[model samples]
Target chain A: MQRNSKLSEMAEVKLLGVLPSPYVYRVIWALKLKGIPYEFVKENLSNKSPLLLKCNPVHKKIPVLVHGEKSVCESMIIVEYINEVWPQNPLLPNDLHERAVTRFWSKFADDKGSSVLKIFRTREDEMEQVKKEILEMLQAIEDHGLGDKKFFGGDQIGIADIAFGSVIHWLTVMEEGILGAKLLEAHKFPRLYSWLKNFQQAPVIKENLPDFEEAVAFYKGLREASLGRAASK
Target chain B: MQRNSKLSEMAEVKLLGVLPSPYVYRVIWALKLKGIPYEFVKENLSNKSPLLLKCNPVHKKIPVLVHGEKSVCESMIIVEYINEVWPQNPLLPNDLHERAVTRFWSKFADDKGSSVLKIFRTREDEMEQVKKEILEMLQAIEDHGLGDKKFFGGDQIGIADIAFGSVIHWLTVMEEGILGAKLLEAHKFPRLYSWLKNFQQAPVIKENLPDFEEAVAFYKGLREASLGRAASK
Candidate 1:
């Protein structure tokens, strides 16, 4: 077993992630927030690279972080590992209960937030259902997730904030692609909307987000391809 | 906010879970193994109970275990919460690295095992692709997950075992429902196959599992409903 501190300084930290995945973005935001220098390896999901397959053979998915020879898979797990190794800018609260609450919301973001994409890919009727779900998701976050705190963990951005930051940012792009409108209506979700502006303006997040026009264009192409496939079927 | 031992004797333990969900079965197995008595609250997914919605307002999903006043959502998170609260029968390893590895596999199982269900629900041509994914998932587990151990954490049924146990058992029932077989063949994945048998026969797991026939019938109904909806479009 490798000791936590025994990781070699000479060894490089390599992150395997695909563009546009919120899971991948969480890791990037964490690394950037902590000022950790790392090499980013872009993965093509269609033709997965050999290293990605070997590193994460079980899932063969991205957001695999390799520190020394040991590789950790799953986005949140990787973030946890990074927190333990870095320990400088803490992403999780020190208190166990607070940590548990943060983890609960983080897990919620992961398991539920993916449904936002259904709005873009499904039929018109199904899109309406997805819209309802998205509104409910935003409402829950607005009510419980942020109770007048600047971030999910209060003063500073923590794991839960990072988790939702990716969702809200990417959802804006997806909302534009699917509906030609923003879903995080500023008036309806005032706290969440304000937090979104604050979050994107944070130094690490501000520097790392993908170009708006490029992301919008990419999702537009994806939407067209999915619609074309649905039409043929 | 609640202290650990305050609710130990005075509080009641209640589990809110859907009948057919494998995620829910994991909590049942864990609680049963610890000899902790609890009340069961079955949830209707279509019309969620007020308690279910109130307890897990973030996700509003099943497998929410309410201990005293606090409710924990997400299956593995709930299992970990159960382990922390109960501690009589340890579900995770003692060593930190082993614990991390166990967690790694548990997360892997949660993320990747859904492909088996995809195989059951997909079109005939798509079944082949899903089958390939299922085989890859099984192969990775057999090679890296089992490795000459009686269970995932060696001689004990830890979190990884329980996570995968639900998945492997449900895959068997799904195969029977679909009237097709490919992945988890004894000759191909002997280690995982044997582990599956051992996991099913474990005393707590054996007693808590839902009837195989009932599970098969339920899955069949689900499969037909999904296909019917798809065909209607």
Candidate 2:
């Protein structure tokens, strides 16, 4: 896609990220939803760019969004920044209570949602514990995080949806490919199951996800390498 | 302070928390700074109040804020809710990029600041790692976070300050009283040391801090009980 000169005029927006990262996709989806034009730089995980290091010195992780000269690191923080900067199609709800609730879930995504990533690095006994935590995480969101709301922040695709959407989808892809078991089963989580349907079908998110097979293969290779390192240790 | 029904009409604000809790203090400082009136319900951490469990069923932790009928959990989140609900005295900076920067440091408090708490729980050998992390956390803020600016967000006291403040003070109280060491020395962290002085001198913060000697004694007793429990286990 050609750069929209009009959009770029406000500020130079750039994203530093690696492929097959739901965190990176969170930023991509938020930008696309808000209709903000940004250049995407694919970062090599092994050899991080000097710009990435300078932008996010504390964590040294991404996706870091450089808006003009200021850079915002962490996935959801970048989403919130995008929402605030480009307030056209509001990603967070307007109501103060709803905004706080959206942020609560967004924080939940970071605190609890990252537990699923342990599958990549855990031993057999630890993977069982990780899987249990994942189930409890899914159950909590299913029971308390969603109702018949269609999306987490109600009818609109809000920030919380963007936060958890990446986790739910990619978790499923990894579970299906590696474990050969359904972590997000319909019977286990009917509410979350339906939420998954409504969330992905949204035009913005639907178009932005990495290809299913490619992502699975990528995660498989990454997981094998991770476990292999664990074994060597 | 007595509850004013008139103030409650605008929003019936109630805080659920136990005394001597730094997490609880973050919300208290923000509310007091904003000059919002509210009733405080002291919770028993050993046996939590039903209201505490109900408002924050997910985390089941204290420092949950109830405004009218709505509730917000997580200390920083509650501070944010207080900022939004009562925007008279803003805790966050107004500039879009500055707000992102404020949130980045606030998140850093949770991600990095909590490592300092290990002194309360860990054995002597573990203290080295904990102190190393705390030093790095302080250095990150000194070397990169603060500059000639008085506060993390600039001249005025901001959200990031409040977030990091609770962690620093609590760690100091526990460290000084329990460990018998000064974790935040002026010679080591000149910028942060000046920040602590400026932060504590601010009327709202100065007035709200727990009685220092009393708090130290309380932490000393708690530490002995905690460490004794660990020994038995």
Candidate 3:
């Protein structure tokens, strides 16, 4: 973590998160995009810390961004806060209509993107339904969300792009590294497929994204451990 | 529906919604608060119109705010857009932290507030679980969301207040008119109960709110019709 000696005392940012969390990575990408320096506090999900419990009593969830005196929970909310606090690299567009559109897609991603993660835990009978749902989500993005633009906010990577990046990255991890599925085929969802490539290669995101193989291993270990417990019981 | 002859040509706001929808009311309250005139276009959700399909192809859900050439979908997003477009009665606070906190609760309402409605559709075996979920949601808000403030956004009723207003109102209608359940007991959740009164009696909200008896009838009719279909099937 880089410390700004001049302004370190005022806005000391600390992120409480587990490394493999797609939600946590959303905040990390936003903070890195704005060139903000923060301490990365690793949290154990199985044994949550007192600080995490104290700060986010309601949800007791990860990716709690504590800035100076106040703490903000929830990933996208934290991203929006970081954007507002440090308006250097604007996460949202300038035009008000564009901003509203940006928020629409961001909200869409938050609402629907998590279903792709269910692929990891799904039984054989339910995989098809989950896959169909995810494909429909991709179709929505391909048809209406991205319109021949470089990013969701266009030209510059914005909030919506970051919001989808985590989902796409994990989707890729599950597809290529674990399940070897072809849900996000270029032929079917060309625009979304291209958008994923663009999002992955974006400067800050490219550098900071967790290793694909590592995420695959992490998820695989989790599945096996859960299965082992089930067998033992 | 009020029309501003002067600004009608430029903005031309049209709300596509059903009157009984709690989500639709959220957008209506925000628009009325800002004193923005809009044409209310009633939608029969049973047979969705081509206009609704064209405007919101993705979700095809209601509370679509069509402003001239642009259309914004999703209720809370529409509310936020209204606040941004017409900055008259500000929906969000000036302070950044307060704004983020407000968004947090608003998201919480969007995520959790719907469980109370599940009571209407819930079977006898599932009623206890659904009731428990709603109670937990109410307790969270009572404990952390409202801290003796007149509104969630402070003295003024803002975005968070509007976000919760719909949920709280629907919960009351179900409890008082339909279920007769003692879920929101004043002794249990005193702050939230008072906040509901404050929210319901607020200037624009008081006048614009749908009739409680009518809403009860609508929901009851809906439940009976669905049950009839289930029984026949």
Candidate 4:
């Protein structure tokens, strides 16, 4: 077992992820935050790479982090591995309860925040339902997730912040695809909106974000294709 | 907060979960294994109770575990919370690497195991696709998840075991709901099938599982309702 300092230098870390997925971006941000150099292999979700299939055959999904030969799947689990492998900038809190709370919000973001995508492919009535869900999610996060703290886990940015940071930022860009604006409006969720701004300004996040124009264009194409399929049906 | 001993005695740890959901059963098995006394509040998912809504407004879903004023949502998160609040029979390994592996499989089970549900709801062609996914997931677990180890982590049943145990067991019942029998053929996935048998016999799991007849009847009702909805559409 390698210690933290040695693992950083010795481990050949590689990330297999797509370009635009917020889940993949969480791993990228964490690796960059820890100053761990890694080779990035972009995967086509339509035709996943053999390495991804081998590493995570259960899910056969991206954001699979390979350190040396050991592969870790699931976005947040990869982030947690990165935290343990290279403990320079800690991603989790020291207190057990605080850590649990951070994990609670992080898991919440991963599970519930997928509704943003649902808003994109859905029709008007379904989109309204998705909008209500987004508001309730944002409200829960605003009430239980953040207080006066700059990040989800006190002063420094941690895993929970990384989880939610990617979510709000990407969802904001996907707003054009939603067809109706409701939850992310500044008045309704002012603190989260401000947090979004603050989060994007962070150095690692700002440097690593996907090109905004391209992401919007991609989502637009996806929405069109989905609607086309529905119409044909 | 409260110390572990005090929590075990005074607090009532009630699990709010639906019968058909494997995710809910993960928490149930964990609580039972720990020898913690608790109440089970069975939820009618179609008409959610005020308590379920109040406890988990964010997702408004099971399985929510309520301990005093605190409520934890999401299945695996609730299991982890149970592990923390009751430290006697540890579900997760103490070693960092082993913990990461346990988490890796737990996440795998949560994300990939849903393919079984897809088979239950979809038409023949879509069911074939979902069956392919289910086979791949089962094979991966057989090859990578369990080797010489009796359980996922080691000799003792751990978090990964609890997570996948419910899925694999419930998948058998769900198979009766589906049109085909492709997931766990005795010839194809012998190791996984054997593991399933071993998992069922484990004392904690065997005692706490829902009655087999009831589960089959419940799934049959769900299957009929889903088919009816599809035909109506």
lDDT of each: 0.83, 0.86, 0.88, 0.81
Which scores greater on DockQ, model 2 or model 4?
2
Q: RMSD of model 1, in Å? A: 4.8
I-RMSD for candidate 4: 3.0
- Write one digit per residue (lDDT tens) for candidate 4, span B1-233: 45443233357778998775888889888888888888989899889999999887767889998886567788888888778778888998876667888999888888888887665577666676777788888888887888877788887888999989988887887776455354687777777777788889998888878887788787777778887999999
What residue runs in model 2 are displaced by over 4 Å at the alpha carbon? A1-9, B1-9
**Residue-level lDDT tens digits of model 4 in A188-226:** 777787778778888888998888888888888888888
Clashes of each: 0, 0, 0, 0
DockQ for each model: 0.27, 0.59, 0.60, 0.30
Candidate 1, A1-233: lDDT as tens digits: 55365555345789999887778989999889888899999999999999999988767899998877777887877777777667888998764445667888887788778887666677776777787888888998989888888888877889998888878888998877778777789999999999999899998899999888788888778878888999999
Question: Number of the top candidate by lDDT?
Answer: 3
- TM-scores for chain A over all candidates: 0.93, 0.94, 0.93, 0.92
Residue-wise C-alpha lDDT for candidate 2, range A1-233, written one tens digit per residue: 33323333388899999887989999999999988888999999789999999999988997999877678898988888888878788887777777888888889988988886767667677677888889999988987898778988889898899989888888888787677788899998999999999988888888988899998888788788988987898
TM-score of each: 0.78, 0.95, 0.95, 0.79
Candidate 2: residue pairs that collide: none
- lDDT by residue for model 3 over A62-131, one digit each (tens)? 9999988788999999999999889898999987778888999999999999897887777567778988
Which is the better candidate, 1 or 3, if ranked by lDDT? 3
Instruction: State which docking tier applies to candidate 3.
Output: medium
Question: lDDT tens string, model 3, B196-227?
Answer: 88888888999999998999888888778766
Residue B188, candidate 2: C-alpha displacement in angstroms: 1.5
